[model samples]
Each structure stands twice: as C-alpha cells, then as structure tokens.
Target chain A: MNKSDNNFLGRWLANDLSEKEKKEFENTPEYLAYKDILKGVDKFERPVFDIEANLQKQKEYNQTYLKNVSKGSKVIKLRPWLYAAAAVFLVLIGLRTVFFNTTTINTNFAETKTWTLPDNSIVTLNAKSTIEYNDRSFTNDRSITLDGEAFFDVAKGSQFTVKTKNGAIKVLGTEFNVYSRNTTIEVQCYEGKVSVNNGKNQAILTPGKGVTSIDKSALNSVEIKESEPGWMQQKSTFNQVSLGRLIAELERQYDITIEKGDVDTDRLFSGFFTHTDLNTALKTCFEPMNINYIFKSSKTIELKNR
Target chain B: MPEQQVSVCDESIYDQLYREHAEKICYYLYYKYGDMEKAQDIVQDSFAKLWMNCSKIIFGAAKSFLYKIANNASINEAIHQKTVLKYKSTPQKTYTNESPEFQMEEKEFMDKLNQAISGLKEGQREVFLLNRIEKKTYKEIAEMLGISVKAVEKRMHLALVTLRKKIGKI
Candidate 1:
C-alpha cells in the first residue's frame, strides 16, 4: 500500500524485476488479484474491423485519386497550347480588323459554323468557307466578301451584297446560297430575289432560280426548286457535277485527301450521299460510275478506272 | 538515418501496418470516446490521413501518427457530441445467449470490472486499457501518449493497484 513500494510493481510487470523478485511478487495476494482483473478485461472483446473491406476502400480511393491526377496532367499539358492558340487567333483578328473593323470567320475542313452578323443576319458557313465584313460599316454598307460556300438568311433592311473574286451576288432581305471556289462561282436564290454579277455580265435570280459562272463567264440561269443546300442537312447533292469538283467537295466535307489514279476525273457524276458515312458516300460517288477505289489510310483515298 | 528515408514506406508495408493496428486504433478510440461509430470513423479518417501523408510519416512511427490523429479527431468529435451524450447510456454487452444463472454471474463480474476501471485515474485508465484490453506494448503507449516508457509502467502499476483495491473487496 505504500507509494514507495508501488514502483517495484511497475518494474515487475515490465519484466525489469529480477527473476527472484518476480517469483516473490507472484506469490503475493495483490499480484493474483491484479491478474484476475486482467483476466476479466480479456473476456471483454476488442473492437474489430473487416480488413478486406477496408483495404478494398483504400484501393478504390487510390484508383480514383490516380485517375484524377492523370486527367489533371492532361489538362496541364493542354493549357499552354490553348493560351498560345488563343493569342495567335486574337493577333490575327486584330490585324484583320485594324483598318475597317472587319470580322473574318473561317471554317476548316469537315467543320461547319453558324454566326449572326451585326445586323441580325444569320449566316451558316459550309466547310472550308470564309466570310469577312466590316463590323463598323455593316449597318451602312451591308457588304461581305466570301471565299467559299455560305448560306445566308439576310435581315430585311437595306441592299446586301456578297462580293467574291470572280463576281458578287446582291440581294435585299432574301435567303440564298453563294459558292465561289477556284474559277467557278454559283449563286442560288432560295427566297425573294438576288442579282448575280460576273466580271463581264450579270443576271437576275428569283426563288428556285440560279446561275453559275466559269472564269468570269456567266452561264444561263437554271431552276433549282430546293429550299436549302444538301450540305446544310449533312448530304452532298450533285446534279450533273464534274467528278473533280465533287471529289474536292467530298475532301472538304470529310477532311480527307483523294488521288485520281489514272481515272477520268473530268467525267460528270450525279448522285446524293450522306456525310456521316464516308464509305457509303464513296460508294455512291464511284460505284455507279464503274470506278474502283481504295482507301490507303483513314485520311487518304485513291480512285482508279475499273 | 534521414527522416525521409525512414518515412518512405511503400503501399504493401502501409497495408500491412493498417491490417495490424486498425482494430486496436478503433477500440482505443471507442473506449476513450464511448462511441463505437465515432471511434471507427475517426480510425478510418486517421488511416486516410496517414495514406495522404504516408511519405512524411515514418513507418516505425506510424502507430504514433495514427494515435495522434485519432486522438485529435476524437477530441473534436467529443466537443461536437457534448450536446448529444447519446453514448453515455450505451451499456456494454456482458453476456450473450446463455443460461440465466451464468448470465447473472457474468454480468456481476463485468459490472465489478467496469466499476474498478472507472474508479481509476484518467492516465492510469488509458494506459491500463490500451495495454490490457487493446494489447498495446508499453513502448507503443509511451510513443502514442508522448510520454516515457517509465511513465506508462507507473500508470499501469497504479491502475492495477487501484483495480485490485476496488475488486479485491468482493
């Protein structure tokens, strides 16, 4: 019971006591009583856990955490390129608009874009097309320069003109499709009236009426009767169009390169094909004409005479 | 040895350590806080934190780290549950399905054991239970409580002496 004697018991339990002292301590009633208490405590169960379940939880945490880290690394890799691309784009836009507040929009191959002009005119640009206009003078001038195909729903206000290198198409509050590529230019009016002008001549186009030109020379106006272009609905429609031009259109729409391997590319082909399936489109274009085609890769194709 | 070198335990070692000490940690917190659910939650949280900083805590000292974090979590939880005090009435299960006579004797012994343990001083109670019930070594108790091994031994001795004084009367 003495405080001085308690230190011996502490050392005895820690096995620090000598063997004779342990033997002597074990014979005491107090040691036996303490052992009984410890035995009682041993009866009480220690809390347990399912190690397998907890380990499974740990494994899941690690997997999800590592996935996030990998995803974060990808984002980090893209960050610098995103900023650089944005900077280059802004610089180009600034340079283009430096003189007259021009807004230039261009779409790459296999891409389509739609934009609203400053005057609330909706313009849907086809693949590989560009439209540039003066944002500052849009309400006053209403003029746009087109390098490729675009469908326009002009807001009714003043005269609207689409100028190209080959010619220009002028309208007022009408829906129309204008296509200018290489030496060929085509303007088809869908709603109201539009006037097409080549370098040497001009023609008036009403709804379902259109005109085509080659090398600044105008062709006779023809009737189309279509409400919209096939490309707008993911279809490529050709009416007695040349194979070379059709192949060029397919290349732009599908972002692929095609080589004419000893085939008459100048032959006229007429057919329609969906844009979602490239193999079907190729079949629709070449199979009916008895031509053989081979896809060298996903991005390259070759056509030969059959 | 460099602390970093000692601390860098791979996943397998950490997993082994978790398997070895996780239940003891849970029971330790449960006895201290009197809430088995809260104790298990704190143990899980401590393991999560340990894994997050596995490279910073030495493998040899991981038990101490687990105890330190588990203790802190229990303290915070104690403060939060002060208003509830729901586990205060949680009676320990003393007997399972057994004869009425055997159950009565078991309950009486369990009541005496609980009373003797409750009669001990706080330090002695912790050291004794962690050692006798949770089966922790004196060195481990010393490291976990940030005390010397002598202190743990003294606490264990005093706890046993007190328990003997309380239970020996019967």
Candidate 2:
C-alpha cells in the first residue's frame, strides 16, 4: 500500500502516525492498495522445516568445529590457537579412503589402530577387534559391524550403528565404547545418547549409563563415572568380570599366551591393568586373588596359586 | 561464582536455544540471501559451530553468536536471487461478498504486488517482509542487523516506495 509521503507511510507502517495523519492517510486512494500489499505479503508461506529431523542431524557438531571466535567478550574462555592443533588433528584423520566398497579393518594381537570412517567419524579398535562398514553407503547408512571391542567417536550426521553378534548400539552422534564378544555384550555411553538392542533385550542409555548382557539372557544397567573408556587412557579396567575373559583381554593386550596353572579361570576378577608395563598389569590383575604368575618363557606366563 | 552458570553443553539449555533461535536465523538468512535451502544449511552449519564452541560461549551471548555465524556463512557461499515468495492466503469472507469482476481485479492486483515485492532490492524487501509478515519491530530488526533503528526505517520506507512505483495504477 502506497502514499506519496513515503516518510508518512514508514511512520504509519511503524504504527506511529498521529490521529490526523491516520485519518488523512486512510482517506487517500493509495491507502487501500498499500494495506492490500501488506496484507498480501503477510500470507507468504515460509519454507516448512522438519525441526526435529534437523536437530537430530545437527545437534552433535561439537568436537571438530574449527573457528575460534576472536572476540574475547563473546567467550567466557577463549581457547589457545587451535590452528596448529587442527593441523595435528588433520593428520589424525585416516588417509585410507574407500568408497563404493566394504572395508573390514582388524587389529592383530596386542594391536589397535584408529580408522576414520567415510564421514570422518573415528573408530579406534581395541586389540583383536574388527570393524566393517560399507564405505559406499556409509554416508547414508552409517552401520558398522563390530566383532570385538572398540571406542567410537561418531561424527554428526546420519544414525550410526554398531552391530555385533550379540547386540547393536545405535546413536545419532556421540562417543561410546562397545565390548561385544561371544555371548557377552557391554556398551558404555561416554557422550550423548545411545540405544542398545540385543535380540531379546533393549535399553536406552544416556551418558555414563550402560547396559551389560551376559550369556544373552537379559540386560543389566551399569553405572559408570568416567567420561570415556579407561582403555582409551592406556588402561583396561574390569568390574567383576570373569577371570577367563579378563585373561583373554590380557592375552590380546600383551600378545602373550597364559597357562592357567591351578588358577580357576572362571573366578571373577575386579581390577585393571596398564598396557605400558606387563609386570604391573599382571600384579594388578592377579595380586588381589593371592595368585602368582611365573614367566614360563619370553612370551608366556603361567598363573598358579601363591 | 555462587550460582551455576548456564552451560550450552547442557542438552536442555541447548534445546531451548535451538527452539528460540533456529527459525529466526533461518528466516533471516532466507530473507537476506533469498535461498531457503541455503539458509537452512547455513543455519545448521552455524549451529554446529555453536556446539563446537559451546564451552567458551556464555549463555548470554549465544544468540548473537548464532546469528553472526549464520550470517557469515550465508554471505560467503550463496548468491542472492529474486525472492519469489509463496503466500498461503486464508480465504477472506469479504472475498465471498465481492463481485466476480472485483475478485479477479483483487487477485490481479495481488499478482502485481507480488512482482513488485520480488523486484525490490533484497535488503529493503527483507526489512519490509520481516516487519509486515514476521511482525518484527524496527528496534528488533536494528538489533539483528547491528544497525540503527533509523536505518531499518529507511529500508522500510524505500521498500514501500519502490513497490508503489513498480505497480503505479493502484
């Protein structure tokens, strides 16, 4: 709607016109057309947004966002220069690129490696673990079939899933560690929300909450304190886990064969081991049980009663 | 600090910020940049940036951070085009009583008005539509654009003037 006095029109649009100005403006022929124009424009349909869907896709963009706001007042604490850090991080991004095919990466005994997924999500496999994904469709369907144990730092994108023989852990974007071997599957969510589903059991896990299923019977909620897996920090921790399973982990980690000499392998052990030192690991694992370990050979350890 | 500071990392607080500002940021970019999809993408990217820098940003300054990030990203990549806005008109009761000829005349006038709106300079068009359609006050527009209220008023005045000139017979 138009009037010759555009300044008056502007004031009128702002609803700041005087009574006389309003009356005179209303009397003008252009007033109706202007009103029509304003009324017509008001009906313009904004593009429809699937807000929840958008939130799902985008809500997890925290880890690698590059720019640091230069203004100090805008930030409570400005981080130090991240460009050098970013350069180092860029090197951490795996150089292996496989598109339109399936890539199965497995670690050897006492070996672990970090592989950046097609979408830049990073997965660091624990020793003797294997992770497989279709690189072609990974951007769309981010499903990784995991064999053993792995800590995942999933990028913000589509729904990411870690399927195992026992169960599957599904998340949109977050970090979590999964231990899936034989009939035991344990998932600990370090960051964000995760939904774990075994064939007969299902549970929703928020950060620090986890679920453990042994022998495929049922799921039990496990409370944890650490923000991330202990193994990520060079320590393999256990909470009442079986001595046999713990021994298996120790073997995978140390790359050594253990001879169970009179030590009940089925006994539950509640302790941890450092990957840095084997002697320390052995003491941490077997000392509480009053068990002793003798070095049978250069690469073999024999466990026996004290 | 005696009381706890609001952390943007908290899901509930972050969700609240998203609900409050996401649409506004999207619409602002769409209005200024004239690409709905690109506006949305920039919005998502900026929010991602927000999440990335959540810890450093105080809750008080988050809104400006979002808009600034979105504005920068939108400006860098996208090119402005004719903003062909679609109006979802509610059928008016007055239209039912109007003569068929008068109804057609009204529809034709609306068509010309739509063309004029698209033909107007994009900044002025954005200001005008944000005022009329989004119901944003001149003060709010000024704050959003980091400008004086008088500048927004000028854009508003110019928008109306250009629209009037483009469709003169009205």
Which candidate achieves the best lDDT against the true structure? 2
Per-residue lDDT of candidate 2, residues A1-306 (tens digit)? 233554566688888888987998798887886787777676566677677777776654433344333342364554566777877776666443334357899999888899999889999999999998887777788998999999999998779989999988899999999999988999999889999999888899999898889977789998999888888888898887889999999999989999997888888987689988999999888889889899989799998898
- Candidate 2 colliding pairs: A1-A33, A1-A34
Give the DockQ-based CAPRI class for model 2: acceptable
Q: Per-residue alpha-carbon lDDT of model 2 for B39-134, expressed as tens digits? A: 788888888878767899988899999988887786677554445655445566754677889978877877887778767776797788788768
Of candidate 2 chain B, the 10-residue stretch with the lowest lDDT total is B80-89
**Predicted complex 2: DockQ:** 0.25
Compute each candidate's TM-score over C-alphas: 0.45, 0.45
Scored against the true structure, residue A268 in model 1 reaches a CA lDDT of: 91
Model 2 chain A: weakest 10-residue lDDT segment is A63-72
Q: Tell me the DockQ of each model, to 2 decimals.
A: 0.21, 0.25
